[model samples]
Structures are given as C-alpha cells and as structure tokens.
Target: MAQCVTAFKSMLQARLLEEKLASLYRAGGRIVGGVYIGKGQEAFSAGLAVHLEKGKDVYGPLIRDQAGRLAFGEPLLDTFRTYLGVITGPMRGRDGNVHRGRPREGMPAMISHLGSLLSVVNGMLFARRLQGRLGDSVGATSLGEGGTSTGAFHEALNQAAIEKLPVIIAIANNQFSYSTPNSRQFACGDLLDRARGYGVQGYAVDGTDLTACVSVFSEAVKRARAGGGPQLVVGSLLRLSGHGEHDDSSYIPDQVKSSPLGQDCLPYAESQLKASDLITDEEVRKWKDEFLMEIDAALAQASKEPTPDPFRENWRALSTAGLVEGQFEA
Candidate 1:
C-alpha cells in the first residue's frame, strides 16, 4: 500500500504536468485552434507511456496535447510549432491534423486517417519480423468511443489479428461522442468484448486507476513483444472538457449524469497516497510544489521558443518529394 502511495503521488504530478501543458498550448502563439487536452484522462496516457520504449515503439496519438508527446521527449516549442504548422517543428512544421505527426525517435508521426494507419504499423511489423528484429513493439492508438463504430476500427483490429501484428489498440472512452452519450454509442457495456471477435486479448480497466492501467499496458507490451498479436484496452477515462476548441460547457446535459471535475486520475492517486503512509504529507506537498515549479519553468521557457522558420513554406513539396522536373528551375 505504501508503495502504491509513492507511485500514486507521482501519477498526480504527471497529470498536473499535462494540465499545465494544455494551458500553455491554449494561449500559445502556435496551435491556437489545435489545443488537445488530456486533463481528466491522464492515467492511461502517462501510465502506458511510462512502460513503453520511446525509440523502438511507434505511437499513433490523436490526443495531440503536449503532455503525451512530452513523455516521449518532445519539447514544448516543437509541439507548439507542430500544432501551428511552423517550419521549426520536428516535422518541419508540416505535420498537422491527420498529418502523421513528425516521426520521432520512438513514435510515428500523427496520420489523420486513424484506422488505416494500423496497416502501416502491420507493415512495419512484417518488415521487423523479416529482418529478425522480432522483439516487442507497441503501436498505440487513442480512439474516443465514437471511433469504434467506424468500419475502420473493425478493419484495423481484424488486420492486426490476422497478421498477428504487434499493436496495442488503446480506446480512451471518455464516454461522449460529440454530444451523444456512450449508451447512445454502443449496446456493449464495455468496448473490450468487441475485440474478442477478432481473437484479440481484451481488458476493460478503470481509466482512473493509474497503477492498474500501467500494469495492463505493460502486460500488453510484453505479449506483443512475444509475438502474441494485439491487445484491445478500453480504459474508461474521465472527460473534463468537450471535444475540442470553441466548445461551450452550457450544452452538456446534467440529468443524464456527469463525473466530478477533479475526478481526475492523477488527483485521485494523490488523495489515495495521502490517506496511506506513503511519503507523509510533506512528501506530497514537496512533489506538488516541485511539479508546479517545473510547469512554471516550462511555461516561461516555452514562451521564448523561436517562431517557426520563415523560409519553410515550401515544406510540403520538399518533404513529400512531390517535385516536378525543372519545376523551380530559374
């Protein structure tokens, strides 16, 4: 229990980090309309990220906020640049919504067509298998509850299962699809059962349980490494905000039921830690203050991030090699 407390407090700190990054992105010069926040669902993102290898594993992230990306070592300015479409971004400011984000050391760049990218991951798996690089590689995809209804979900899951590919399909069911609720979305009480049809291993965990989430993702990582194909993890996370920018909270129906705002995975962990003899209240206080300071520092430094390169407007044609012979000849 004490150990759980220690791990728990750290989990809260991670959530705080994510929140700070979200705020920075919202007001940042770049990524004005591209602010993706994982405020209530910190556990699954931070926990799973902790277990996977940054360089070897490729991530397909739709939850495009700085926290998730930062876990993989992405700098604040670079992410801002990516969101704002600046040339200085890792993807040369070319990556954006549906633009498989800048290919980093560990994760794949964000590709807009989420479901189809599974095929790309499978192709990478096949290549790795043929090259005798037959080790573990987790290709994580974050899907809201609404995505499961798409034919793409069925197709991606089926392809991975048939090929016995190494992928972990993580469904972050924060429970709302645009304006509709989960019941309106699916009859299945949990999304885990849906993957069973494809012979995929499935687990539906408490999205707020940080330790549980980490353990499950770690196991999934292990199985994929051992040629065990794919695992479907539908973690029920708390949603603190609506779908995206420009959304107003006045519309969310109250009688239909709602979660407490601070029902966040990280704060929950912190409270649990305080209840037990983990590190004493002082430790928690120290960590919280320390994390806040780091966030302030990140915010301050992020402001100083260089603006996107001015001469990168031709970035698209250059990166895609979509050049025509003598097209730019003087």
Candidate 2:
C-alpha cells in the first residue's frame, strides 16, 4: 500500500511538472527542445521505476518517461534545469532537454534512438556481472511499440537472453507511434508475441490501471532480480497527447479517444487510492498544490541560472580523459 501511494505520488508529480512544461513551451521562448509528456502512460512508467534500486539498477528512460525518471530518484530541479538550459543540469545544458541523465548513478543519458537504450542497459548489467558485482541487481529500459520494430531492439534482447542477464524491458503500446497507429507499426496480433520469439518472460497489463501496473511491474522486477533472465511488459494505453507540444494530435480517431484505453491514468489512480483507503480527495489536492509550488520554485531557480557558453566549455568527451588531443588520430 505504501509503495503504491509513493509511486502514485511520483506519477502525479510528473504529470503536474509535464503540464507546467507544456504551458512553458506554448508560451514561447522559455524552453529549448520538444515538450513530450507521458500523459496516460504515467502509471506504467512509474510502476517500473519505483521497483528498481536507484544506485544498483540501470534505468534507461525514453522521451516520455518523466514519471519514471522522478520515481527512479531524479531530482525535480534537474528536470527544470535541463529543460530551461541551466548549465548545472546532468547534461550541462549541452544536449537536448529530454536527453538528460546521470550515468554514474546508473541512469544513462538517452540518445534520440530509443531502441538503442536496450543494449545500453544490457552492457551495463553485463559489465557488473563481469566484475562479479551483479548480486541480485537488475537493469531496466523502456520503449514504445514503434521502437520494438528497430533492429537494435531485437539484437539487444537476443543478447540479454543468450547471456541470461537480469534485465526488464517495458513497452508502452500507446495505440500510436507518433501519428502512426499500431496497425501500421507491426502485425504480430499482440506485442507480447515478440516476447515468446525472444524466449523471455512476458507480462501484459492495462497501462491506465494504476493498481495493475504496480502489480505487474513489481512481479517483472522480482523475476529479473531472481535470475529469471529478461522480462518484457507490454502495457496497453493511448498517448493522450501529441507526439510533442507542437502537435495537436488530430490524427487520433474519436472512437479511439472514447475507448477504455483512452482513460486518463492520473485521475483513475487517485480513485484507486481513495477506494483502497490509502488516500483521500483532500490529500490528493494537497499533493497537487505542494507539487505545483515546488515545480514553480524549481523553474524560477533554473530560469535565473546560467546557460552553457560554447567558447568557455570543454568540448572533449568525458570518456576521452586519458587521451591527448592528437593521440586518437593515429
């Protein structure tokens, strides 16, 4: 019950923060890159994140994983700093806002190619195993239905299966990939079918059902940590928003919008908590108020902070520390 409440709170915080980010983006001249919110997928994202150990497990989040990032221990201020181009962010404001992460803390900085993240997490877990330090630790990464079609996804999952690595891959089948619906993405009948082909354990859950997400993700993490090899969770839901703030999402059909999958997870989560006697409407309101104030303060602080100056910044990559300027040219 406590875990569910905490995860729900993180989802609520992410939703509120993303909402503010959308408003900031719409106002113009405030944000740097695209504004993508998880919207209806928050429950599924947060569910996986809340179960992982921050310092031990590797988490590779995609563009729409604000909820997971928060639940995985990313500071609220970091999100604002990254989006607002504050030089103190994880990326030092040198990368896109959505590409921010703290690698040393087990979360790799995301690249534009979401499918590649699976291999990134696999490499990290494989490295820990090689060092004889992979004691019950697992690595998890997320993707959309579209990402599953990429070759990187297939190769990485195969690698994990072959090596019997503890890894969890969460796929949010949010009905559409960008403006493309699932019909155009793949013809597997169900995304879980891919899990069988990969020889990994698979779980399917309703992305809008907070309780189901919490239950499913918990089991997935547990199985992975217990040396069950890779686990795949395919969540069914709708994006509920545009691919970015620039899009109005007119592509989504009205029938799809009215479907059960289109239900907003945030309010549904609140209702779940209330029914379980874990939280009340008044408490939910208080949480929203508190989170909004915190978000406002963080944004204000980040807005006033300095941005990166190209001339004064070190252009060298962190991994090239031991090499001289001309050493790699040979």
Can you tell me which runs of candidate 2 are displaced by over 4 Å? 318-330
Per-residue lDDT tens digits of candidate 2, residues 162-212?
999999999999988899988899998989998899899999999999899
Report residue 23 deviation for candidate 2 (angstroms). Answer: 0.5
Model 1 per-residue lDDT tens digits across residues 1-330: 432543454455556655654565566654545555566676676555555566787766666323445554455455444555544556654455325364535456655554665666666667777998746666666677778888877887898899888888778777777677787889986688778888999888777776677778778877877878888888886567666554544456664335552356766666655565455678777878987787667555544555456573543455435364555545
| TM-scores, all models, native as reference | 0.81, 0.96
* Clashing residue pairs, backbone N/CA/C < 3 A, model 1: 54-106, 86-93, 98-112, 99-110, 100-109, 100-110, 100-111, 101-109, 101-110, 136-225
Single out the weakest 10-residue window by summed lDDT for candidate 1: 1-10
Q: How accurate locally is residue 154 in candidate 2, as Cα lDDT from 0 to 100? A: 95
Please state every model's RMSD to the true fold in angstroms: 3.7, 1.9
